[model samples]
Each structure stands twice: as structure tokens, then as C-alpha cells.
Target: MSGHAAFAVTVDLAVFTIRDGIFSVLLVERGTEPFAGSWALPGGFVEADEDAETAAWRELREETGVERFEGHLEQLRTYSAPDRDPRMRVVSVAHVAFAPDLPAPAPGSDAANARWWAVEDLLDGGPDAPPLAFDHATILADARERIRAKLEYTTLAREFVAEPFTLPELRRVYAAVWGSPPDLGNFRRKVLGTDGFVVPTDTHGVSASGGRPALLYRRGEATDIQPPMLRTAGEDD
Candidate 1:
């Protein structure tokens, strides 16, 4: 039997957020070799003292300068393809997070640059676009699929909005996440009819068009959305 050689494990994060009605993702330009000058998901090798989750959170904070992320953060999956990393045999445990707001980031550690990019622009692969390092493009795609699936049956959509938000704001979250604009009336009925989905705060948001103020609501105690909001056939980002 052949003896096992050394294998290193790393943690990466695919952090997502919505700002100015656009879906954005946090990315970093690698400062070191193995794909220097390339854009990648924020992450690094796990330290001896920290577990995967701790490492993910620490790496995210270090790269993005966002200390507190107010949204759903969870492990997406482990990627162990043989040639995924050019260095040694590396297995990356990629985590995903969805936050409502993120502060301006200052690149730190091995990241040469840090910024939020529009999802459409990132996938466009134009001359000005930065290529993803390692196997990050696949990881980012997986993260997007996981988020879409979660939206169908979980309360995760609420995490993309402020505490007290209008129905339009919440619907925008759904549309942004799904990359498709759902029918407004149908969406409103589904959300309001879903028990424990949201509770009105007896307040309204001023209409930007100077019409009637829109009613505001907050997330309820329910974690699951009954009659899951399924995506349609051929619907894609």
C-alpha cells in the first residue's frame, strides 16, 4: 500500500448582497502566486487553531472588512477535484453568505484588491472582466444554485431586505435572486397568504413617486415557506 502524502484543506466564501437593485458578489484579486492577479472568492487555508466555520468568517472579514454579516451563512459543499488547485493537493470547503448590506472593503492579507461586482458583469467574461482563480467559477455557480433552491422553501429571501421593508423591496429580492421578475400580484398574494411569513409593523414607506405609502413588514418566526415558491421551467440567470 502506498503511504498517504500531505493534503491541505482550505475555506472559501462566496459572499452575496444586493445594492441599488443589482445583485452583487464580493471578489478579490490574488496578490500571491498560484493565480496571481486573478479574481477569486475570498478565502484561505485553515489555520491550526480554527475550524472551518471560524476560518470562513475570519477570512471573509479580513478580505471584505465587513465584521458583522446580517444574513444567512452556511456551508455549501466541499470541492475535491484533483486539479482544482495548482499548488499541492488542496480540498476547499466553500461557504456561502447572503447579507443585506456591506461596507466598503479594504484589501488585506493576500488580496491585492477587493470589491463588489455585478453578477451579470462577472459572468459576461468581457476584456475588462477579471477571470476567476482556481475552481472558483464553479464554486460561485454552485453557491448561486444553492441560494435559488433555498429561496423556494426557506425564509432566506427576507435576509436580503432591511428590517422593516416594503413588499416591493422584498419582491425585488426574489427577482434579484432568481434573476427573473415574478408577477407582482401573484408574489404579493403568495407572501401575504403564507402563514408566519411576515408580519405588518403598522408603518409605511414613503412612495418615491409621491403616491400612497407602501405598507411595511418584517420577517416572522416561520423558517419554511409552505407551498414552496418553485421556479418555472427554463428559468435561469
Candidate 2:
């Protein structure tokens, strides 16, 4: 078996979901050697001839058994730390995806037990996550940075909101992620000015419902957020 060293690429995904207005992620505990018994992002070595993104999507399906998920996906970067893998030198292209709604995750394939852990609770390792196996801590930190960037200059926040939402409702999404709320008047005007950011409705909640009726709005087709919703960085919070 001389010169039989295996050559491979690995793909790890940070699949995020928001439900009940809190952020969460999907993770699995490895059941095999080479980091077995330790938690890691849902992932595996890319099969031969598989493209990076394709391998990532396939890994998501195999490990999580999820048929459909709609939201943005992006390449978060790669982990090539020389000492990243103990058995062999390996490189992993990482990814981060957002899910509009929460779905229960179950163990599959090489995972010992699959689960969805809340964002705040997940990192703390209390009833959700434990320090992940491999260099997953670096992977997770990378994913979080990308999502933070996605929050600005894009409509990514709406994915967490229901079909219909008011400015105040949407504002909370920003506040939740930014740790501090943005200026309401500035935020409202910023969104309204951006084409395809939100669409108007002829039939409002009809402001005279014997209460202060809220205005109606839905997701805009435009992906670009004009004036890019500014925010303080996560660490600044």
C-alpha cells in the first residue's frame, strides 16, 4: 500500500434557522474515528468528481435529510490549518445557509445524534452544543461573520420574518442581531426607499380598527438594499 495516501476535500456547513425570534444552528456528533464522539458541523469528505458547492448541498441532505430549504447560501471560506486533521492533512471549504423556519434535526449517516441548538444556548454548550470536534470553532466563527455581513446591504433579515410584517416587527430583527436597535425613523425610511425591499398593500390592517392599525407589507423582489442598513459590528454589542 505504498503511496496509498488518500486525497480528498471536505465540506462543512453552518445551517442556521430562526424561530420564535431567536437564532439557531444544526450540528451533529461524529460517531467514527478521526474526531469521533465530538460535535462538528454537518459535513464529510467530498466524493470524487463532486464540486465544492454540490458536495456541500449533498452533505446537507445526507446528514440532515432535509428536502427543501430556501434562503441564501454562501462560501464562508476554508480551513487549511496544517494541523487541522490529525490522521491526514485536509482542507475544508465551509458554507453558511439561512433557513426561514425551524425544522427538527435528527441523527443520520455518521452522526451519533443530530440536533438543533439555539444560538445563545448553542455556543454556551448548555443543553445544545459542546465544543465542536476538529477546527469547527473556527468554522462556526467564520459562518457567524458572514451572516453578520449578510444582515446589511441585503434582504436576508426578512427570511426570519413571516410573510407579512410591520416596520417595528422588522426592526426587532435588526436589533436582535445588532445587539442594539437602529434608529426607527431612519430604518423605516431606509427600507421604504429601497425598491423591492418591501411592497405596499392597498388593503392595510386599516389603521382604524379601533386600534392603531399597522400597515401591511411583504418581501420585495429587489435583492439590493439601497443605503445599506448600517449596523454596529457584533463585538461592539
Q: Could you tally the backbone clashes for each prediction?
A: 0, 0
Model 2 scores worst on lDDT over the 10 consecutive residues at 228-237
Please write out the lDDT profile of model 2 over residues 104-155, one tens digit for every residue: 8767788888877665565545674577788887788778767867777888
Q: List the residue pairs that clash in candidate 2.
A: none
List per-prediction Cα lDDT, in the order shown. Answer: 0.85, 0.77
lDDT of each residue in 1-237, candidate 1, tens digit only: 479878899999988888788878899988999899999999999999999999998998887677866678899999999889888899999999887777777899888999988776777574676779998888988998888888878878887787898988888888887888667666766688888889999889989999999999998988887677766633321
lDDT of 2: 0.77
Q: How close is candidate 2 to the true structure, as a TM-score?
A: 0.85
- lDDT measured at residue 233 in model 2 versus the true structure, 0 to 100: 30
RMSD of each: 3.0, 3.8
